[model samples]
Target chain A: MASVVPRKSHNLRYKTLMAWLFTLPGLVVQLVFGWLPVLFAFVVAFQRYYFIKDPEYVGVNNFKEVVADPLVITAFQNTLWFAFLSVGLTFLMPIFVSILLMEMSRRTIRVMMILWFIPVASTAGIAIWKYMYHPNLGLLNGILRGLHLPEQKWLDDPVLAMFSLILPGIILFGPGLIYIAALQNVPEELYEAAELEGASFWRKIWNITLPRLRPIIAMMLLFSVIGSMQVFELPFIMTGGGPGYATTTVVMYIYSLAFGAYNLGKATALAIVLFCAIMIMVGFQRRYFPENIDESSENARS
Target chain B: MPLIPQVGRRRPKTRLMLLAIAIFLWIGVLLHLFPVAWMISASFKPTLEIFNAPFRLIPKEPSAASYKLLASTVNANGQSLNVDVFRYPLHIYLQNSIKISFLTLLCQLPITAMAAYAVSKLHSRRAAKWLFYFFMGTLMIPGQIAIVPRFLLLSHFPWPTRTVPGIPFTDLFFPSWSFIGTYWGIVLPAAFSAFNFLLFKGFFDTLPTELIEAARIDGASELTTLRAIMLPLARPVIAVTGYFTFTGAWNDFLGPWIILMSEQQKWPLSVALYKLQWALTSWQPSQGAMDPALQTLISSGVGYNALMALAVVESIPIFIAFLIFREQLMKGIQIAGLKG
Candidate 1:
């Protein structure tokens, strides 16, 4: 032991050098793509930046413009409304379905998961939905006609447009693969124990199952909230920010500002505002939910 | 054990509950599957028959017309319109998607795994903590904030500003390469993903340190230890991360759209699909709003049916990938600490 002590210190010095060597390529990538791009965002946010012109520092004028724009307000309102709708319509539906799916036989669960897991590329899927929402040639309208129900212009009408956007997710109420994986980790003994005392199904779920699943549920909620705030592609593709401005989300407005009008400074400012808003939401969530990543890994190990 | 006890499953009340659950799940599966079913069937149906009343799942008179159209360079009139955009045919876009996805995986996986391994095992504790955060800090930040800046950087890499930096006393400016129209623009930025970094680190952390130390003591070089010992053990993590990297690269729309928008021949299947959909919507089949150039194409009877066929073509690789990585993906996420 005495003889090995000096060698151990020397070994650590070697390890440190080797570690940096191992890290060199990833370091360059993160610097180029991850860190440097983010650093430029702040620089652009503060300056009257366009690609072709010299950046002139404008001292918060970009932020001032972002705040004063009525469309910015409208985009925020739409984003908040979409967030609320996503919570009500789609959020916990996966957890609830996965719970019930756990009560099914393994064979049925396997078949259901495989079928549900089949991929339709999101752009393709959105286009498929676009075809379905077509006023004259769509299968959705065809179904409405078959049932003798009045056909509504699904995507064209502003009133029902956002609803139409989320309608597929509501119908495609298949259990999430993540939820099923978490549900499988739930201890059956807890349910069995609940049964011995004459607990109902819902009661067993409340008393035993939920607490076991709380960590994962909290994390999924955090992700969905962050994800929903930056909802761009669905609305962008489905309606191109709509017949009017009904579907122009925050990120959609940012896209228009950057790519559409070429006011990249203002666009970056608006994006910074969005970034702060999401960070605040995440702060509150972490405070309340207190997700422990280490604890979940420990549970998995045991 | 199943959450619902097998013993109680025989009881009448339990049986009814089971019945309800079965019906709910089956309906969910079928409802979700209908759009996919329609995508495939619509691809085969004749264009006029696609809009026919009482829409059927299987085309009554199925035809491979769209598939043939997808294969050919010329329109149904056999007039080659190679000068027009969207006239490059499907194979070029498919090839671009495969190329971009392959190159991204080739660059990203090993580069990220090496960083993750260093942070997880090799570095000193204090250094590990800081390096981990330096790499993982982007996890909380949404990537969209940098879209404009990233686009600018790609147009003239390593210089997001209007003018490239010059030496203080010299007239010469730094050399800059434009990545905007190349596959490198997409492939390079994707070489580091903070999300995948989290996944790799989580996986590497769970691996025993003693095994690594033993390998080192046995005179194996750090690279050899990683290549032979750690890599074989890391197959599950590699497969899971590789699957995600491939899918993300395949399905990515905005990146390719921004980078390759001007270079029409470089567009991936995602960008092509979006263009097709946008085109179809703008020129509603044989309508007055249609451009005459597009009107000819629409008149050739390759409208929504051809779009559906393209969509089917785009989704085939992703479905194939899911089949290959189905088990690892589901099992690996639990190790990702999503499990409770």
Candidate 2:
């Protein structure tokens, strides 16, 4: 019996060691690339770092410089405008689209989904939009000219550029995969009950569908806000933050500061500020629009 | 009073609603696909025909001039346009993208799956809880915060600066090695994704422990069991995760844009396309006055046609990947959305 106990302990130790061996590589990668850089971002935010020289700890000077930079304000305003407009314009699209799609035949739905989500590379999508937005030679202008309408500078006009950046998303809207999945989870009994009550289609959607979709809507809202706030590639590719800083987002500003100007410290400082803002927004969202529906019902059922 | 509406009235209204919905959705789909179709059509048009009036959706005279330009460096005038800016051919950028994406997959899949398996099945309850948190805690923090620091770290590896702890002077500090201007810089940081780790762990949790225990009793090692038993059952998860990872890495722009900026030959198609667009568009007549070749190229509209061709090239692989993994990709999204 004593010998068997020792052997069991030996086996346990070997198992633990094996577990650690499996975990170590992933842990090392996460530490070096994920956690360490995040920690280093805090440190870099307080220091002045030019690649040519050793970093000098400036103690809030980078933050001060970030504040002083006139472009910072413009970037923030543009980002906020983008986030608000994107949410207002496109957030509920997938939910409504999914509801409409639920009425479609299965074959039709599949065909529509394939057409809608064609897997165009994001940069390629941006390039396509950039060409379409061209003033003189673009297809949009060509169509306008054919219609005998005056051609407008789509991207070069400061007022229209930000709107133009998001225009493609609005036009290409479809049911998000998430929303469809959520819609599928809406109990058939609920719809049957509504049908028995003679509730109209719109009423059923408003009363049952929207309420059930609230949790997903809230979650997607948060994602959209985060995504739009960090808008970089579209504006960067389409306008180069051009038409005189009209479309320069906070992220694009940080990118230019880091790479274009080699002002690493200031860029990190701005990034940290953006991080804090995003965290606060997330916190507010969690408090107000809690994702408590799934868990509570799941626990009740289980 | 009747509890339900009369079938006679309800039938037509429902059919009308269904018809309206179908019409609306079909229009939406057509509008959604318009840009992609336009891109393909524009790619086939000659530079002059692209700009010509009447605005045909189908090109009047479809030509391979733009594609031929991308395939080779020399234009019809026998002048080297160097559209990619670094003078490397289009295939070189494609090769770099493929190499980096494949390396990322090679490193990411096994490392992530192993860690997920350990957390999901091998670890003790308390230990698993802690390890899962450790891996997933990074998800709460936005990735942009790490961008600058990561760039700096890649530029001067092991140490972000020329300073080491316990060393008296800054001069004594030296980086172990730099990953800048290399594929490792892009591939290393992407080797373990917290989101994918969660997906893997969730999938693995659904696997029965008795199977693994049976393998153990049959004298199979943990690695052997994972390989010979768990992997066969994990084909769907593997396919979904692999597709996401490959497409993500393939389409990543900023990472390659920053890390491989100086090494233009190593730039991916995304960065190369960006540079090409910038160079072509930023070419002012005043700037090109000294170079007749530049003026001729600008006036010919070849740059615009070539840009469209590049866009087509960039989108083809992702389209093919989607087609191949269509079911798995949709299932993955459905699972992720429901779980979230």
Best prediction by TM-score: 1
Candidate 1: list runs displaced more than 4 Å.
A1-7, A288-302, B81-85, B284-289, B337-340
Candidate 1: pairs in clash: none
True contacts kept of 2: 0.67
DockQ scores for all the models shown?
0.65, 0.55
Task: Report the lDDT tens digits of candidate 2 across residue range A66-129.
Answer: 8898899999999999998888998888888988887776688788887888888778888888
Runs in model 2 lying further than 4 Å from the true structure: A1-4, A294-302, B1-10, B82-86, B162-175, B284-293, B299-301
Task: Tell how far residue B1 is off in model 2, in angstroms.
Answer: 29
- Please, what is the TM-score per model? 0.95, 0.93
Q: What is the overall TM-score of model 1 with all chains considered together?
A: 0.95
Local accuracy of candidate 1 as per-residue lDDT tens digits, B131-221: 8888988877888888888888888888987677896799988999899889999999999888888888888888899999899889999
In terms of lDDT, model 1 sits at 0.85
The collision pairs in model 2 are: none
CAPRI quality level assigned to candidate 1 from its DockQ score? medium
